[model samples]
Target: MLLTLVLLAAVLAISYLLFVSYYPSFGGDVPEALQTKYASSENYKNGAFINQKDVPEDLGFWETLKIARKFFFTKVPNGVPAENIAVQHLDSIQIADYEGESRLVWFGHSAFLLQTKGKNILIDPMFGEVPAPHPMLGGKRFSKELPIEVEKLPKIDAVIISHDHYDHLDYESILKLKDKVGHFYMPLAVGVHLKAWGVEEGRITELDWWQQATLGDLEFICTPAQHFSGRKLNNRQSTLWSSWVIRSASESIFFSGDSGYGPHFKEIGEKYGPFEFAMMECGQYNESWPDIHMFPEETVQAGVDVRAKAVMPIHWGAFKLALHSWTDPIERAKKKAEALNIPLVAPKIGQAIEINSLLKPNSLWWENL
Candidate 1:
């Protein structure tokens, strides 16, 4: 019995090592140089990035194991789609050689493309079919088809990364997009993974919270999010997480990268109020992890807190990252938006909208599905 147990243990250890070695989602580590740079920031302390407010941290080993077990074994009816979600395709030629037209296209989840002021910006572009490093791991993307093919898309002006989580910062997508990208703007220390994946070091600019970078006439501000970051098991909070503000002379837009309900929304509103539009996080939430992801009602409230003229919901309709029903987020978010009399738009995947006019695609497309 002892000999058999020893052999099984050895095999399990070897399998884990091999899996981490080849999985693209595992990502690269934060190098010493980058860590040193991050240490100088106000957010990084005691060797990890700190949240602005005190939030729940320890879930306890037994409780965590129980939650994980429930997540895997218990099933939420229609947790995945019976049919693939619909997407709107675009022509590649028009995107590349285009006049300055302010338009935004949704690619589902947190990934979207913004074209304005003669610049094309892609934010959190996760196009892969799976969210995990390898196929067999605990990762599956709801929609296999993106609105546009990555290669067929135009060259990216900037790729904004919110954090190092697998769903938001995909590995295969980055590898495919590296050659066509012009530059990447990310939270501090996130470039370490990009450099390891073959992107040139000069192509990435890392920023701390509230630090701003300019591309053309747009000012990109990295703001705080109530979240944690790590690509692997051991490196939680090694990198920073943030929301973003994209501003031009006439228009200002906000992207809530991934955060729970917090006072930072009001703080952001006070600084950059009366935005043209705000893309707010509205999915992957649960009572078990309330501090990290906001409920659908909070989604609408966050929109109000940001002082946006119009709000579009994101972070759902792409992946089954939570136990809630597949259509629950859009359903609940739409209701809250209506009750609050908030101007809300829930665009179909890949549908393009004119940012200036702010006409919401005002329909619950997910209800039938």
Candidate 2:
């Protein structure tokens, strides 16, 4: 009986591996040419990208098995929002109706739009129904409606993707927004996937950590983020992950594009701050996977570390990607921000943060659900 079960497990594992290998939604791997081109980079060695600080790639096989047992066997009821999330859906056609030098509209999760100085820039616009390869497998988007459909968006000046995770670099969303966007920016070698997705090579710019690119008067600095990347099994870390520092003539913004607690925040603060606004990652965290995602308190600390005068909490209130209560992220971060006296903003989905004015106040609105 034991031998039969061992054989069955081996077959199932191999079958699952083959399934993902053939899945088109998983996205294309880094091409050999790009990999060779980036071979000299410090982050790219042995044909894969490496994190600056040492961290385990994943829980070892035994620990993973243990977690899998708990995850699959135990029911986690608090993993989802109690109701359809209340969001301030915006009409993109009426963007001129609002007034501000710089405007931001978050579309839940990490997707947001930043319109500044006559430019419409999008960040990690994963507007798909799920963060996984397929909606059927990954569940559904929490909010029934988003700020604006991709077709309704104005001509995008540029689109910046933090990394190629399914939750960040969505396939369908990319397809819809690709033509409307003038340029696409991503971490090193991530263009391999975009190029395959039909985005022209000329329209995409790939950057390593600390690299800078200019779009008209705006300067985009690719800063480091304590994160990892891969779309499929064999391609782990072939592409780099990064935060971004966007600076225009009069204002600068720091976007913590999915990162964990790290000294890099302080380094970035000393180098480019004090920023007018900072978007800090504050959700989808677990104690076992401490190195990749930051808890709420850490998110507030990260804002202070970045010397952000005003902070906006992101990466939550959109999806049930973690086991915590849906509102836990905002609630916990709000408490920490109050204790630290850091200015924190929690704008509803599709609500604009007029960076020109005083930062918006936290409403603790999720409790209403």
Candidate 3:
């Protein structure tokens, strides 16, 4: 009995060490002088600590604990293997060559490669193999490999991140592309995580709601979103979550990071209306967290609220983060878009869509997957 107890304790200690090593925690320390200057301000308190209301009441603590336990122990449904994800082989996509206009190529999930004014920008890049701190815990990435590996990517002028969720901000992907990236833009407290991951402070730029910054000939404006942020249990709402408005001389784009149905969308539309294209979240929704993630129909409404000329649905078809069927988000979104007469673009993995051209209807690719 004594020997068995010793063995169990040793195993538990090793597991704890591994967890700490993999998930490095931060956010306790800020520059004391800077905090003293801004801590007591109303903007610092309310704008920084933006509280999330209307969190759906379906899942209680015990219910969540039960689901989490089952998820940890049960065999994850292997929805589609990496070999099945379609890939379009293109030598290069020249945005500058396309009559000096903007274009977008989705790399899966929420990652997009946007080109405008002879510059390349990557948004919410998550090219890692898994979405969890440990590979054993999270869902697998859909593609066999990234459309372009980190080293093979062209010189990136800027990288814009929406928030620090695992699916959006991957650790390994950031580490691999850190040296190649010229600048990084993200929400206010997310710089702490980047600093923990070894990104130089000089390279990181953090912004609050309504703040705008210039990158090359383009402007990046941080907009509001109805979402919350926390990598761990105790730090909920310690950071800000937001959507982004990307505007160049000729075109404008809105990238809605994960968000629920909120009045902010209409407000943003009134401010930055008639966008050329909008990339909106359209998956991983649940009744228990309805305030954080919009349902499929709500996503369509959000596009209308933003006054986008066209919509490209994202945050689906990559990982099964929710319990619904794999294709439920797209199926529902398609019907709603058609009913509302919203121009929706559902491209295959790694496919590029021109902003001015008409969107083609592809087969239901997720059916076979």
The lDDT per prediction is 0.87, 0.85, 0.77
How much is the lDDT of residue 306 in candidate 1? 94
- Top-TM-score candidate index: 1
List clashing residue pairs in candidate 3: none
Query: What tens digits encode model 1's per-residue C-alpha lDDT throughout 1-369?
Result: 999999999999888888776765687888777778778999998888988877547677799899889888888998878887877787799788777558898888999999989898999988888777666766566676787788898888889999988888988899889998899999988888898788888999999999999988989999989988887666888888999999999999999999999999999999988798999999999999999899999999999999998888899988888899888887888889889999888888887888866666557678666
Poorly placed runs, candidate 3 (over 4 Å): 1-18, 21-48, 52-61, 70-83, 90-100
Highest lDDT among the candidates is held by which one?
1
Ranking by TM-score: 1, 2, 3
| C-alpha TM-score for every candidate | 0.95, 0.94, 0.86
Expressed as tens digits, the lDDT of each residue in 40-130 for candidate 2 is: 8888778888777885367667997887576555666666766787678677667634445787888988898988877889999999988
Count of residue pairs whose backbone atoms collide, per candidate: 1, 1, 0
Query: Residue 4 in model 1: shift from native, Å?
Result: 4.1
Model 2 ranges off by over 4 Å: 1-18, 96-99
Model 3 Cα lDDT, one tens digit per residue, 149-171: 67667777889999878888887
- In candidate 1, where is summed lDDT lowest over 10 consecutive residues? 356-365
What CA root-mean-square deviation does each model show from the true structure?
1.7, 2.1, 3.7
Candidate 2 — worst ten consecutive residues by lDDT sum?
92-101
lDDT score at residue 154, model 1, on the 0-100 scale? 83
